[model samples]
Target: MSQATCPQCHAPFTPGQRFCPNCGKQISSTGEGVIPTVAASNSSLPPTMAANSNEGLPPTMAAGSNPNLPPVGNSNPNLPPTMAAEDPANHQQPYSQYASGAYTPPPPPSYNGYPGGTPTPNDPYAPPPPPGPGMYSMPPIPPKKKNSLPWIIGAVVVVLVLAVCGGSLYGITQLFSKKSTDNKTQTTTDNNNNGDNSNDTATKSVTLTNLAISYATDQITFTSIEQADQFPDDTYTKTYSYEKKSNFVRIHMKEKQEGGRSAYFSYSSAFSLILPDKTTIKALNAGEFSGPKEGEQRENWVDFETKKPVDLNSLVLRLGTAEEAQMEFPLKSNADLSEYLPKQADLNKAFNYGPMKWTLNTAIQRYDAPGAQAKKGKVFVIVSLTASNPSSSDFWGYDYIRLKSGDTTAAPEYTSDDDDLNDLSAGASNVKGTLIFQVPPSDTYTLVFASGKNLSGTNVTFSIK
Candidate 1:
């Protein structure tokens, strides 16, 4: 048979159903009703459907609303008593059974009313029963699992960064430390070598304090020493300025010396040092000293230096000219400088030269030269010379004659014809000429003939003091 639909809700249901399960509306078997009658879900059962009640209608006829079906009351002997359990009351009472604490599972649905199907034993599609009243409590919701992966990775990165930085810093520190240690070691070694060198110089050097030595015409007493920086010292002083540091000592007694051969001793080459190798160096920075007068003491400081280091202990004082230094008592330093001066011919004598024989007849000082006047602190010296050329080559007398002192030299005055000694003819035999020289008034001088026409190095010396 085709399934019938509920009238009020128009929902498809079984023909034997007395109410719609979806909308719970009562069904009429005779015809579809336009009016809807909804049963209250929690209301008490009607009197006609109550158990053991003598009502107007029987169970099967009222429960199913099927007019063609016979009534099956409790009085029917041919039907089972549970046959009336299909009533709507019995159909909706399963939930109430749970509420009353007596729930029981319902039987599987019958499929005999379905098309082409017999009743199956187990209906897999049946609705499950509610659990017993006290049997259910929802399983506790598990706490949410937390994730720590990002935190772990960040911590690892931080640790790696710190490790790299620490390693780099340690390496840099070690490098600097090693370099500093090496520098310190080198400095210490150099200092030790310097100390050894100082010891050696000390062994060779002699003490200078209060050491007195005798000379030819004077005596030298050394009182103190300040080593050199070796430039010329224009002013004389007992002490000096230096560049480096040393063990400096002071002198209570001033350094004293006496030399009278050259009255201007401090400005001349009077005091000198004789080295062990027989080499000599003159002192430049000495105290102001002068005088050939008797019993006169002069202050002096001997400053001497060399291009190379030497033994100071073997050094000797040479108080006069270097050619006349004395080592023992009668040493060469005892000779008068004038006696040891270079050999010179007498003014009245005739000397033979390279290509000529010349006689220096006489000399006289005047206030005026041939063509030029004498300077304020100067005088004019006029001398007559007789010359003869014994050689074939011509010679010039003016080119060969000159006056010389330590560093002062004067040429023949060339302002007039009388002063021109160049007029002496070549190869002449007896030529006489007058030459004039402007020189300082009060100094010792030498007359020199340095060269001739046919030769060189004539270099004859004559005293003109």
Candidate 2:
């Protein structure tokens, strides 16, 4: 029997043993008489085994052949041809032939110590065992997606922007609505105020009893009022030419000073007459005069002329300032004119009016002058008067004196070469002057002297027969 090494455990074994007692690998006698030659360069076999068989060895233990071992004779003629031996001194096995055998591994035997069958070299056809726990790890769980904080932040920003824009639009709308409402309210209020003012202006009335009379800074009291009317007469037609005929109303008022100051009144543009129909007539002419010194009273007159006859009962007189505190006098025109006309007086007797006295010296009618002819259908009436001012104060001659004949009245004509009776000083006596008047020839006439320019005051009439 030959002693051989167990290729699996490298332990000594008898040649006839079929399996190694140490590693439990199979041992074969078919290797007998086969040279333990190195495998060919292209063959996958162990170097320690012959090329035809690796019967006693495991695949991992096969390396180089040991030439010191004695060669055994061949006992099987059917074996494949062996590699020729080389000289022992220089012999080398190729590194590629080491552990390069094509041997099939056997199935592993059961083992009580391990959980499953142990793998062997000859078990190439066996399926791999299932992997034990913890041997493989699941693919690293993809890290959970981090919370989408950026997306959340972007959404919040968009929402805030929309909210801000919407709020601004809403605020603007409210502001405009409020402004429009305010404007409408103001307009309504203004209209109401205007309506009220109009109502107030339309209903107010002023009257003579309640006439506002003021002098300087003090209010004055009205003492008496006198008025008269003058119609066109034959003398007026013969002496004066007019495109439009008119009637004259003379208004006179005596105002007493209530305060301790002399009051002066001016009649320029300060008079207007409101007719029954509410038509207003401005003064045709005005005159100015001063009232008596404090507590004394004097009369002044204002004249107005109109083409249409006025209803004196409904007439309203406005005097003084054109603005505030205008004096209003409502008059009655039913007074008899004969009561105010003077009675006929002799030419030699003196006639007295206020502080002045007058005497009619002569009356004559002439149709021609020294160098000028009298106007056709007209005659000149020349009257000589002697006036005396007995009062201490100067007397202003009445410029409104006239001559009346039937329905005619004639104003004095100053065109004659006669001295005018204007200002007369105190204590003056026998101031003689001639007053000339043009009139139509008449059978009867009266020489009249008025106190003031409107012919409203005392009148002295001298009958010329």
Candidate 3:
């Protein structure tokens, strides 16, 4: 808020001041000498500051009018004292700034060995200026976020691959080891068998119809394991329905007929799974089921558990029992049994035997229901027959007719539901029925009819297939 000083005398002056009081010089900061005007009326000032010098003035006759106010121009009483001289021929400092007068600017000063491009400093103690701004550029882009699902999936795939390779290697090792052990066991059994026949009991043949060796193995199935530290049951069932344990494993076996008889799986039976490390895991399910009959099957399940999953590679299922079991199908393999399954064969043929006209319909075998299924290595053959009794007397067909296959002969199965043709009354026409017989699968078969007492006098043979 301080005032500016005069450049001539260094005396302070206000903003609107037109002259320096101590030097008697006009100011040009008010733009006095910039505009053009008639020299007779122009009021102006000098460009450079001067204190006592009059070098810019020209020789004039009116000098001593008033020395204190610096000589007035031309002594023109009607004109202003600040106005320049009117004579165009005499163009000095103040008159040179007239409307028609010509003037020239002084040469610029030099600094730091270069031409003046920066402003001259008035305050010698001021600080230096700061450096200029830098060049323009664009902002940086942000990075994208990543998903974790693909990484998790890749990790899982790698784990599964490692597990499969390890399992396959373990299985191969166990297979070789099992073969070696079985060879040693067979050698020991042979040596023992040659010495005595009464030593072996549970694995000995009982009769011609029942043997001790393994036979028809049922579907052996297992379920995914469930692991827990606790269970909800005090006693475990064969199916592990209400029981649970750590590293639990359950296997289901159905219709396991051994040596033409059931395995006789009971609550007292001992079931186990042997591991590759010779560790045996005993079955936890000791629950009992009803015993199976002849030509039937025994269905059961075995459950085992341990504290940790160890030595579980290449397992072998085994069962042990008293002498009454007669059989046990352990360590079995999957085989194609499609040829043993019963199926129907269609046949339409007309023939005559004795007093009745007969039309043989079909011969089919089925195993869809219980007790109706054939035993292992055997099949059921039921032949449909349509008969017309034209005579007046009743005829019994069971006694006079017989079916034979290979070296085996079969009579009518009277206990079955297919015995309607065993007896035909008089005038009964187009009576259709079947004769059921259990037999083995064979291509050669014959049906025989006779017409004498006890069917022994005269007989007629009809080829079946």
Candidate 1: misplaced stretches above 4 Å? Answer: 1-346, 370-372, 396-398, 416-420, 423-427, 452-454, 459-465
> In candidate 1, where is summed lDDT lowest over 10 consecutive residues?
245-254
For each candidate, give its TM-score against the true structure. 0.23, 0.24, 0.33
Residue lDDT tens for model 2, 377-453: 55566677888888888866556568876677888775543454677789999888877777765666677766564
Order of the predicted models by TM-score, top scorer first? 3, 2, 1
Give candidate 1's TM-score.
0.23
Residue 294's lDDT within candidate 2 is: 59
- The true-versus-predicted C-alpha distance at residue 172 of model 2, in Å, is 99
RMSD of 2: 28.0
Q: Clashing pairs in model 1?
A: 216-334, 287-301, 324-332, 324-333, 325-333
What's the lDDT for all of these models? Answer: 0.47, 0.51, 0.47
What tens digits encode model 3's per-residue C-alpha lDDT throughout 142-224?
78779899999999999999999999999999999979966764664454335333233212111111112222222223322
